[model samples]
Every structure is written in structure tokens, then in C-alpha cells.
Target: MSQDLLFQLNGVSKSFVKGKEEISIFSDLNLTIERGDFVAIMGPSGSGKTTLLNMLGGVDQPSGGEVSFDGARVDNLSESALTRWRAHNIGFIFQFYNLMPMLNAARNVELPLLLTKLSKAQRRKNVETALALVGLSDRAKHMPSEMSGGQQQRVAIARAIVSDPKLLLCDEPTGDLDRTTADEILEMLQLLNRDHGKTIVMVTHDPAAAKYANRTLHLDKGKFVQRELVA
Candidate 1:
């Protein structure tokens, strides 16, 4: 393993069983991601883009081969171990801001820290820092309904980064926002990758959203068909 490498998938394959048939998503797939890299994955509905992101984050496992992170094998981890590993190492962002409707921005951002042994004060401080980073410090006390879509997404981003995870797996992160708001969210993701050294893998169908990433990959027929240097 190279010191700079963050994630590696070698000979990975995934399949699911339907009513009476088996569907293969990917076969013998391979990929590598390095530290501090911002990568965008673009593909059609059934190209397995979201599956790839899920596997990378330990939300799903390959049927064969291996998934490794920082030189450690992740596919072989037990359920409980994988849960712990994911909580500590992976942050996820979804198309719809998945913030708890009842929780305020600060509480939503502090959710990740609750899994750790940090004191309440420490957790509060971490939440404050994350909210400030996402320019939501003043809105920390606001409920999800009180914020706009862009502001809610900002809260989601803060929640994702609050744990200081090694990897951020984003699935259509800006798909729910307007063009201007989407650009703002993408810019914040770029800032996190460039300034905070966070490795991000985002799945987006929009080329404009992919443009925010340094590298863009196109997946089709269970394979990566093209690669572009967008940044």
C-alpha cells in the first residue's frame, strides 16, 4: 500500500437476487482513491454508481474480492465491527438532506459524536466548529423546517464532516437544490477537499456538479467507460 492511498477495490464484484433471477451490478471491478482527492462518479440509473459508493463506505459488501482502506481489509469485517469502522471513518451525504426534522442544526451535527466517548462539552464544541465551517453558526438553533433547502444542505454537510472522517461518500449531494445553491454546496465540498484534506467520492448525474471535482469518471454497463480531468 502506498502512503498516499486511501481506498482500493480489487477484483470486486456485487450481485443481488431478484424474485427468480440474479442481477450483477459489477464484476471484477477495480478502483483506487488517494488521500485528499475529490472524485465524481457519473452514471445512469442502473450503472451501480450508488452501489460503488455504498461498498466504499462499508454500507454494502462485495460478493467476491476485497475492499481495502488505508491498507486494511474492510469487506471481511463483521457487522458490528463494520458499523464501528464506518462511524469513525466514513461520512455520508444524501441527495435529500437527511437531517432529523425534530433536531436543531447543532443537534444534527452533534449526532455523529454521540457514538464516541467524548464529553458533552467537547461534542458541543465540535458541533459549533463544524457549523461555523459550513457558515451555519448562527443557524445552529434553527429547526430543519425553518431553513431553506440550501441552508438545510449546509447543515447536512456540517453533520457529515463533524466526525472528521477519513472518507466522505456523497450520493447525488446537490440533486435536490437549485443551480445556484448546488454550486454553493459543491464549492463547500471543494473547500473541504482542498483545505481540510478530506477525501470525497461523489455520485452525480449532472456534468456541472462533476466539474467541481478534480477527477470525473463515467460508469456504464458495470464498467468505467471514461475518465476526465475536470479541475
Candidate 2:
């Protein structure tokens, strides 16, 4: 592995037992992601893009081989350990924003910190910082339903980064937005990757969204078949 390597997967494989047979998602997959890199995983559905992402974020274990992040063996960790590690090191953003409709933006962003020992004041400060970073500081008290789709997504982004996680995993972050709003969200992600040195791995089918990344990996049949450079 290189000095900058952030994630390493060696001989990784995943399969499910289907009735009387095994369905292999991927086999003998070896991949590396570098720190501070903005990477996009692009492939058709059922190509194991999200499965790979789940493994990277410690959500799923590989059936064989090792999944390592920052030199730590993620696949080998116990369930509790994995949960703790993910809470500390990984930030997740999904298609639906995943914010609680009842809570305002600041409280939603503060959710992750609730698991920590941070004081309420500290959590509020972190929430403020994250919202400011996403240019949504003014919307701190607005509920999810009160904001536009784009604004809600921005709040979701703020929530993800509040803890300063080492990796940000976004699954179709702009899938629910209009073209213009999607572009804006993508631009903010680009800024986080370029200006703030955030290492991000996003799974997106949109070619336009993938273009924001520094590199794109095309996955097929449990392997990365092509690598495209965008930056």
C-alpha cells in the first residue's frame, strides 16, 4: 500500500445463500482508495457498488479476505467495535436526506454527537460549524419539511460532516433534486473534496454527478473494470 492509501481491500468476496445455491456478488476483489481523494463508483444496479460501499463503511463484512481502512482491519472487527469505528470514522449521506422531519436542521446535525461525550454546548458549536461549512447556518432552526429539497440535502451533508469523519460515503445524494439543485449539491461536494481535503466515495449513476469526482471507478462482475479521470 502507498503512503496515502486510506482503504485497502484484498481478495474480498461477498455471497448470499439463496435457497439451494450461493449468489456471489463479487469475488477476489482488490481495490485501494487514497486519502483526500474524491472517488465515484459507477455501475448498473446489482453490480455490488453499494455492497462495496457498505463494506468500506463497516456496515457489511466480506465473506472472504480483508477490508482495511487507514491500516485498521475493518472486516475483522467485532460488531460492537465496527459500530464504534463507523460512528467515529465514517459519515453517511443517502438519497432521502434521512433527516427527522420533526427536528430542525441544527438538532438533526447534532444527532451523531449525541452518541459522544460532548456537552450540549460543544455539540451546538460543532453543529454551527458544520452548518456554516455547508452555507446553511441561517437555516439552523428550520425543520426538514420547511426547507426545499436542496436545503434539506445540504442539512444532510452538514450532518454527515459534523463529526469530521475520515471518510464520507454518499449514495445517490442528489437523486431527489432537480437538475439545478443537484448541480449545486455536487458543487458543494467538490468543494469539500478539493478545498477541505475530504476523502469521499460516492455511488452515483448520473454521469454528471460522477464528473465531480477526481476519479471514477466502473465496477462490473465484482471487479473494477475501468478507471476514468475527471480531475
Candidate 3:
């Protein structure tokens, strides 16, 4: 294994039993992700892009193969161990800004830190830094309901990075915004990758959105059909 490799999925398969039929999401898939690479997974609905993201994030385990991260077998971990591992090594961003309506921006960004042993002062500083990174430092005290959709997503991004996780997994991070706002968010993601050296894997349906990534993998019926490098 090269030192730059961050994830290795060998012969990974995922299946679900729905009623009397068994549905295979991905069969015998092999993938490798390098550190500091921003990758986008693009496919139509039901192509299992999000499922693959869940696998990478350790939220879902493969049924038949191996998933390794930083030389550890992540797919073999117990549920509790996986949870702890995810908390420290993975950051997740969803289509919807998953912020609490009542909690202000700083508090929402502090939620993940509550799982760790950081002091209140440390958590506050982290929150401030994260919010600043996302260009929301002045809005740290505003409630989610008071912010626009784009601002809310920025807050969510702040929350995701507050812990400085190894990988940032985003499922449609700009799905709910206008084109201009979406472009801004994508630019921030680019800055995160280029300047901060954060590794990000995002799932997006829009071809324009996929262009922001270093490479895009196209999936069809649970299989990767193409790998395109961004020029």
C-alpha cells in the first residue's frame, strides 16, 4: 500500500433483502482513494452512489468484501467501534442542512465536539475557526431558521469540519441551492481541497457540480462505468 492511499475497498459487495427478494447494491467492487484527492461519484438514482458513500464513511458495512482505511480493516469493526471511528475520522454533509432550528450556528457546530473530551473553551475556539473557514464567522450566533438556505448549508459545512475529520463525505451538499450559491459552495469545497488539503468525496447529479472534483466516477446499476479526470 502506498503511503498516500487513504481507503481501499476490495471486492466489496452490498446487498439488501427486501421482502422475498434480495437486492444487490454493488457486487465485487474495488476502489482506492488517495489522501487529499477530491472525488465525485455521479450516477442516476438507484445507482448506489450514496450507498458507496455510506460504505466509505463506515456508516454501512459491506456484506462480502474488505474495506480498509489507513491500514485498518474498517468493515470488520463492531458497530460501537465503527461509530467511534466515524466520529473521529469521517465528516458527513447531507443534501439538507441538518442543523437544529433552535440551536445557534456556534452551538450546532459544537454538537460533534460534545462527543469528544475537548474543553468548553477548546470547543468554542474550534467552532469559531470552523465557522470562519466557511465564511460564516459573523453569523455564528444566528439561528438556522434566520439564515438563508446557502448560509444554513455553510453552517452545516462548519459543523462537519469542526472536528477536523480525515475525510469529508458529502451527499449533494449543494442540492438545495441556486446555481450561484451552489457555485460558491463548490468553490469553498475546492478551497478546502486545494488550500486546506482536505479529502472530499461528494455525490452529485449535476454534471456542473461534478466538475469541481478532481475526478468523477460514473456508476451504473451499482457498477462503475467510467472514470473521468477533470482537466
Give TM per candidate.
0.98, 0.97, 0.98
lDDT of 3 at 9: 93
* Full-model lDDT, candidate 2: 0.93
Q: lDDT winner between 1 and 2, please give it.
A: 1
Candidate 2 lDDT, 12-63, residue by residue in tens: 9999999999999999999889999999999999999999989898998999
Q: Put down candidate 3 lDDT per residue, 1-231, tens digits, no spaces.
A: 899999999999999999999999999999999999999999999999999999999888899999999988999899999999999999988899889999999999999999999999999999999999999999988999899999999999998899999999999999999999999999998999999999999999989999999999998899999998994
- Give the per-residue lDDT digits (tens) of candidate 1, residues 1-231: 699999999999999999999999999999999999999999999999999999998989999988999999999999999999999999999899999999999999999999999999999999999999999999999999999999999999999999999999999999999999999999999999999999999999999999999999899978999888888
Tell me how far the alpha carbon of residue 14 in candidate 3 is from the true structure, in angstroms, after superposition.
Answer: 0.7
Order of candidate numbers by lDDT, starting with the best: 1, 3, 2
Candidate 1 — which residues are off by over 4 angstroms? none
Q: Among these predicted structures, which one has the highest lDDT?
A: 1
Off by over 4 Å in 2: none
2 or 3, greater by TM-score: 3
What are the lDDT scores of the predictions, listed in order? 0.95, 0.93, 0.94
